[model samples]
Target: MPVDLETLYPKLVNLLLDPVFVVDESGNIVFVSDACESLLGYTASEMIGTLIFDYLHPDDRERTRAEANRVMTGHPHTNFENRYLHKDGHAVHILWSARWSEDDKLRIGLARNVTSLRRANQTRDALYRISEAAHGADSLRGICDGVRQVIAELFPRNDLHLAFYDPVRTVLTVPDWSVDRANDWVEGSMQPGTALAEVISLGQTLLASRDPSQPGLGVITESGLKSPGPLNWLGVPLISNDSVLGALVIESQSEHIRYCAADQELLQFVATQVAIVVERKRAEDHLRFLAHHDPLTGLTNRSLFYDRLETALKSAGRHNSLVALLYLDLNDFKQINDTLGHEAGDQLLIETARRLEQCTRETDTVARMGGDEFTVLLTDISDLAAVDAAVGKIREVMAVPMMQEGQIVLISFSVGVALYPQDGRTARHLLGSADSKMYEHKRRRQAG
Candidate 1:
């Protein structure tokens, strides 16, 4: 058997990079290399004459032997990868090239280390996780949430701020934003030359490790709005369509890694993605706002009123409280439309809605039923006097004349109230009862 290889030229064996082994027809390891000691924790002398099947990872051995048998005919095959048991008891991923020998009594194979390549595959899988997570985020705030989640991988447990630019304000405006929020968000305006403003002003990324160069954020950290603060910070600007649209700002906790250049690069890439999402979200919000709100009065149109009414009804039912529906129709609505035209009539309706809203509590709802018609939902009522008091206040607010082309025109609303369970439980039933009551009041006043 070629003098058992060791008995022949044993010195030539240690030159290969792969863990080479010669197996006899009986599948025993007749010879091995010095590489075996480094790869498998077995010295060549100790492994020689051992079974080749014994050294293979037990789970892979049978399938590997089957594959080897299929390719036993001497043909140069290339590039296959698999795993094997390592010396430290961890599995080693290996790239393999194997072929059968001409002697028919033995076979040989070569392998290359592939651990780094495997780790890269794991990173690719993580990238897929980000894409899947970010897919549903189409608005600025939704985009903010997506960015918050991705950034969470680095900073994990800190809250972050998101702001977007307002073209009219020429400043960074609060985006759909939250504070460590699960679902709630607030959209509003913020002052210029503020903390986020500094980031947008720089027109570049800012990494604040020990101390930030931006005085706005630095001042806030040293001393907050109420008092001074000790927090260190980092801020990055989001750019889209060649302009800085906003800034994504994150603050570090005491134990955080010192924010570095690499961190800035990662943040920049994430912010770019976030900017695209926020832009789309704003467009969608504008469209949605237009669809559900009144173009003239800015009141909840019939559609939205009914939606809110249903929600209020369900909530009132749960609390075992009452819901009062008020239907107001202007007595002189047609006269204003006829004399001053629809423009004057529209102004009167808008002013009426404003006055009604002003008279109601935050929990109360005021809605425009249509031209010359308005509705109010007085919820969580403890007594009938609450309804009487609310109607009295609305009548007083509406009594004030609205200015129309330098003329003060008085508008009176004939208001009607319908109570839940006593008047009706259904929305349409409540509207019918309220409408009938309004006309009855109108007739009684007309006769008097």
Candidate 2:
């Protein structure tokens, strides 16, 4: 005997892997197939009485509703896509085919889960954004900002934190955060036992959510030690060439939202790209520093000195102010190098550089012009008395004895002064005048 059509139709719908749904004009789910349990993590009984729009991802709701209206107006929708919130709190990408039944005054739809395909596309877009940031950004901070923007799209929250590791100090410093509000973790160091610290220490990804059995993550703040307020945290180490540079962190304050393994994997991919960009930027910065600084004393080099002197001269000209240039050479520095050793001579130079730095104001530029010759540019000097005071302070600091190889070594400076627009207008001319006067002072001291 042949089976009846109504019984066979219901059996065929039950066999479909994709979920089929019938909804009233009010958007209430009147019928849902058993496949909904597998596709949305919701049983048919639980979804039957709920509004279809209630399960949609908040960001995709308006567009989905607009499409629903079209379908109810006798138009058939095919391949219409939107995101629905799964029962497990993750987004499920869905493609739908639906049409309205005028006689029954209901809408019938079939939903095909396309979450994996959508995620692949999202990953591609995210990687493209990171690549653009790496090559287009002018500074490390710009690259970080770009990465933060891409991450915000994926996590869609305001509590993201990015902590950078200082290899020399073995510490993690939070450099960027999404939210503007003050939190203990912003611009602060990550302490031991915190989620960020643990990720850095283990060089792995970690996910922490509200669990009474698990210990709370701790943080150090100005107020004191504190635990992170009820939130879900995910952290992934930024690793490059077997070294962990830092961590990328995502935080969710909503009790309903929790990070899963898939989120961790996506963030890890982003972190890898970030580490590469950061390493490249750091190398570029080191090269730039070496180009403008003295390797021995860590002071500004001759090139940098000339650049600053020229800048100061321009500023002085604009304001009709005075700029004093001081030329200094250690007295008998070569003799010290010959009597003692190069190592001892180096130690003396380093100490002298420190004393010179301490004698000048922060606005002054002090540079080592090869060997024991150094230059100081003091800008915005009010009068001759200010110049004399600065020179006198330098003399006093140079008189202090420096220890070299467990022995006391006395050092002094043969100094000369020149004023902008008075001794010379150009940097080259002023530098020459200072050098000539320095030699004159040295000869007078030797004669005396």
Candidate 3:
């Protein structure tokens, strides 16, 4: 092989990916690939006379020498991994294979661009951290974004998407997406939904592959959506508890080649994390629903009420507005409970909470302070008229008779209204004032 001409004898030193190195028997570097600039940031001239061993990453220098010596001895190694020091002082993990360059005085090293491989290895170890973070996510959007970010870090700037199946299998909605969920490849990204259901259910081809010939988002048929455009799609089945939860589809435009197997694997790992997060979020929502709610009444419990009340009061202070507190108790509740039993009473409380909730604007709050006692906080109360209006609405709904177990119970509520700053500032004081007014109103009703 002539050292001066590369094009004349292209077959003698031609490689598409791995950089080939030509060295003398004494291991002095001569010819290198055009990829040297990308891999090592050095031109061929800069590395021509440098000892091959001089450029190896200090950690991999010994192994690199051993591999070269072994290859020189006529034993060819197909694939091996070692680090090389780039001109910028970064360690490059190269997956190299070698053979003698015909003259026996020269050796050629071929390698895949495995700098991304090293990053992937490091990211795989770091997945546990993302997995742990996924545990605390509560909303679907947050969970999707978390999973996407973890994945995007591994395959930087790649399109990542996660879709979930609703209770019905028909709608494949984008529950929420993580970082850079969709890139420039698609016409528009609206967190694709049932729009891609046909492709998702029909696309049968899937596996661990390194094929870059097809784009990831190709499955979605553009004619099906409002706008027809080129899209490449790749999906991984999301299985949890032996059930198919949904499919996570990753995609990009035609400008980008389809995703590779390494990308698919990392996406699958992220999908698994997404499944965990989805389940966790469901459980948390269930727990939250149980805690801040009465099992029977479906009204805010005392805990949530107190927190809201405090916040409302703070808001009222800023607005220089009065907040009206109404403490209501049903007269003869015990009589109904004792004669009709607890289930009947529960129905009555449920109806009562519903009526009370409906009676006021959404900004106002009505909470079950455990049992027949209910508290309502009405912020920005304009005057006594506003208070009367709210109380009147409550009375109307309460008058809607409760038909429980074929028995009609006409329930009357005694509500005491107290104003903030006018009654007392503290929650305890306001509650006491409302309580006192309620009993006084009760007495008036009985006497009348």
Candidate 4:
């Protein structure tokens, strides 16, 4: 064996699972073993004449070249890792061991494919990061942002979209997306039968490319209206409890990058975690909304109104300012409920709340106390005229006829105005004084 080492070199290379290569000083591959076909998806005959740097991942080429330069100059490199492009266009992670052959003027290297091992490590790390985000993010938006970051770490992405489906409304809406591609997909409602809708309907992950044969799977690019030519797209449904809540989508227009089955699996895993967190956040938000807002009109309820009023009083006291409290009651509301039915009465209340909201400024607060009674708090008032004008606007707006069930119903409001520091010093006092004044106005109207 020692007598004929050079004669047995080819036989030894054939027995190794890892690919062996010999390259010249110019980085041209001079010799490549048959095992390259399994490691790089290219046969030795196809890779023998090609430049070694040509097969490397573009982003990793400079560093790889620098390391190779050091290895060629009388040094050995062991277990140096770099990414190369497979013939199928996916990344092939490789761990290389190389030494310079001074007599032959070539670099002899052995390459072991580590793509699966690297992907496994990345998957574990990504899941850990996603778990942290799921538990630590303060809001739904924060969770989505963390998801986007984790995805970007694993792959190159041009656009990432997080859409939420409203089951009750049968519509899909994008809540988070990259800024450059923000307008790529319209943020409003997406109708049924669209690509995203079909994904939700099927509750399956979709991997789409710009292939004409694949209809209804077009890539969404700059201004969702244009054609996405030669791009790759992946969408995974965010499913919770066997229900599809929405989708997570990623798009890439680069020719160098394409998504594969492994990428799809990873995205599906992340989507599952996202779905759980999103569902919990939505439920919490719904409960919080119910606690702070009136169920009937979607306006601030009594509890929230008192908290705001207290805060406003404190601010007013600090600035030596005045606040206006308008207490309003619909006259003969019970008669309308009795004659027209509760449905008509509810419609009237909802419309009245809308008009009251329109009659106030952005700084003002409108709240429904219960049973046909509403209150408006106008803060930081410099003069009484502003409060008077607001009252007049409300009266004029309410004078218009409202349509309820194909019938025109005329409504009137008795409004009582209370000024801060003059009417009362506290929220309770101000509220009681305004209620008493509202009843006095109602009695006067009845007498008239």
Q: What is the TM-score ranking, best to worst?
A: 4, 2, 3, 1
- Supply the TM-score for candidate 4: 0.87
The clash numbers for all candidates, in the given order, read 8, 0, 13, 0
- Report residue 440 deviation for candidate 2 (angstroms): 2.5
Candidate 4 lDDT over 254-282, as tens digits, reads: 66666678778877878887888888988
Question: By lDDT, is 3 or 4 better?
Answer: 4
Tens digit per residue, CA lDDT, model 1, 260-334: 443455566667666666566667787887788888888778898888888888888888889999998898789
Where does candidate 4 clash, by residue pair? none
Q: What is the C-alpha lDDT of each candidate?
A: 0.69, 0.84, 0.70, 0.83
lDDT of 2 by residue, 392-414 (tens): 88988888888888888899889
C-alpha lDDT (0 to 100) for residue 279 of candidate 3: 76
In model 1, the worst 10-residue window by lDDT is: 215-224
How does model 3 fare in lDDT? 0.70
lDDT of 3 by residue, 1-448 (tens): 4565645455554444556777877889887876677887888789989897877766567877887888888888888887666674445668877887656678877756687767677566547756766665556666666766665655444566555655453444664233565631223232333333433454332422122443333333434453233223457767667555666766543322334454456667766666666776777888898899877787888899888888877888889888999999998899999989998888888888888877788898888987799999998888889888888888887887778778888999788888888898877788889989999999999899
Candidate 2 lDDT = 0.84
Give me the runs in candidate 4 sitting further than 4 Å from their true place: 1-8, 165-186, 189-202, 210-231
Query: Where is model 3 more than 4 Å wrong at Cα?
Result: 1-109, 113-129, 132-140, 154-159, 164-231, 237-247, 259-263, 281-292, 314-319, 331-341, 401-403, 406-411, 446-448
| Per-candidate TM-score against the hidden true structure | 0.57, 0.86, 0.59, 0.87
lDDT of model number 4:
0.83
Cα error of candidate 3 at position 183, Å: 21
Of 2 and 3, which scores higher on lDDT? Answer: 2
Top TM-score hit: 4
